[model samples]
Target: MAISLGLFSSLLSPRETSTLTFTKPSPSSSALRMVRTVTSSTVSHSGPSKIRGIMKPRKVSPEMAALVGAHEISRTQVLKLIWAYIKDNNLQDPEDKRTINCDEKLKKVFQGKDRVGMLEVARLISPHFLKSES
Candidate 1:
C-alpha cells in the first residue's frame, strides 16, 4: 500500500481525533480506568531529546569561527548555521543552487576555494569539527 506523507502527517498531529477504551477485569473490584487525552497542550514542547552518542558539541576551528563566530556547536547545528549564512549572503549560484560561491568569510571555511559543490561541503567542513573531549 502506498502511504501519502501529507495524509500521514495530518493524522499524527496531537489535535487529530483518536480514542482508547479498556474494560475493567472486575466491576466489583473497584478497578479504575486510566485515560490520557491527546492535545497540543499535552504534548512535549521541549527541543530534540539527546541521542546517546550523537549531537555532541565540537570546538569550532579559528577559520570557521571567523564566519559563524567563536562558539561550541554540534555538527548538525554548524551545518545549519553555515547554510543559513550562505543563504543570507546569496552565495548559492543562481543557475545552479548546488554550487556555493565563497565570499570573503566563507572562503576561510572553504579553504580559500572560490566555489564548491554541495556534495563537497560536508568534506570541507569535516576538518573544522574537532573531536569531542571525554
Candidate 2:
C-alpha cells in the first residue's frame, strides 16, 4: 500500500521544519481517524479585491483644468474630484439635488449649459478626456 501527501509553504525561511508521518491502521483497530496539520512562520496578509476596469489615466482638457488640471487622471478620480468641487462650491440644486448648477469653469465642461443632472455629468465630462499617447 502507498500513501500520497502534499505540502505547501509561503515562508521565506523556516527555522524548524515539521515532519508529518502517516501510519497504517492495525487489523485489530476498527475506528477510523484523520489528522491534518499546517505549519507557517508568518501570518498572511490579504486585502480586498481590486476594482476591475481600465485604470489608465486620461488627458484632461482645458475645461476640466479647474477640477483635475491638465495632468492625466483616472475616470474614477475625475468624478471624485468633480463631486468634491460641487460640494465645496455648493453647486448642487437645493430643490432637485440631482441637478448641478454650473460655475464658470464647469460651464465650459458642461458645454455652456447653466445646469446639468447628476446622471448626465459623466456624459458631459467624457469629451474633456482623451486617451494619452504613450
Candidate 3:
C-alpha cells in the first residue's frame, strides 16, 4: 500500500516549502518508508481581494451605526457585531436561546420590538443598510 502527502516547512517570508512524501508500506513491518520528497510554496495573490455582494461594506442609518459603531459595514459584519453585543449583554432569553431580548440599543435597530427570533435578525437589519449608487 502507498500513502501520498502533499508540504514541508523551511519558512521564508510569505513563502514556505514542505517535503511532499510518497510512501510504500514495508512487508516485513507495519511502518511505511518515504520514497520521495518534493517542496512547494503557498500562492501569493497579486492584489487585495474585492469585497462584493453582501460582504461589500455599505453606509448604514444613524440608528444602526450607533449600535455597530461604524458608518459603513458589510451585512455579514453587522450581524456579527449585533450578535457580539447580544452575547456581551446576555440578551438571549433564558427560556429560548434562539430569541433575543431587546435592550434600548437593540430596540432602535430591531424596529422597537421587545423580542426577536434569530431568523428575524438578518431580515430586520436589511432596511438599515442604505442603498449605495455605486
| Residue 5 Cα positional deviation in candidate 2, in Å, after optimal superposition | 17
Model 3 Cα lDDT, one tens digit per residue, 1-134: 55555433434443544454656666777775665443434677899999889999999999999999999999999999999999999999999999999999999999999999999999999999998996
Residue pairs with clashing backbones, model 1: none
Candidates 2 and 3 compared: the better one by lDDT is: 3
Task: Write candidate 1's Cα lDDT for 1-134 as tens digits.
Answer: 22222333346665554444444546566764644444343565579776543377778888877777766777787788889998999999999999999988888888899999999988999888777667
TM-scores, each model vs. reference: 0.59, 0.58, 0.69
Name the weakest run of 10 consecutive residues (lDDT summed) in model 1.
Answer: 1-10
Task: Output the worst ten-in-a-row residue range by lDDT, candidate 2.
Answer: 1-10
lDDT of 1: 0.75
Candidate 1, residue 61: CA error in Å?
A: 0.6
Which candidate achieves the best lDDT against the true structure? Answer: 3
- Alpha carbon lDDT at 59, candidate 3: 98
Winner by TM-score between candidate 3 and candidate 2: 3
Question: lDDT by residue for model 2 over 1-134, one digit each (tens)?
Answer: 33435443323346433334455777998654444454554655487666444465777886686666647777888888899889999999999999999998788888999999999988988888876565
> What's the distance in Å from true for residue 52, model 2?
8.0
Clashing pairs in 3: 7-18, 8-17, 8-18, 8-19
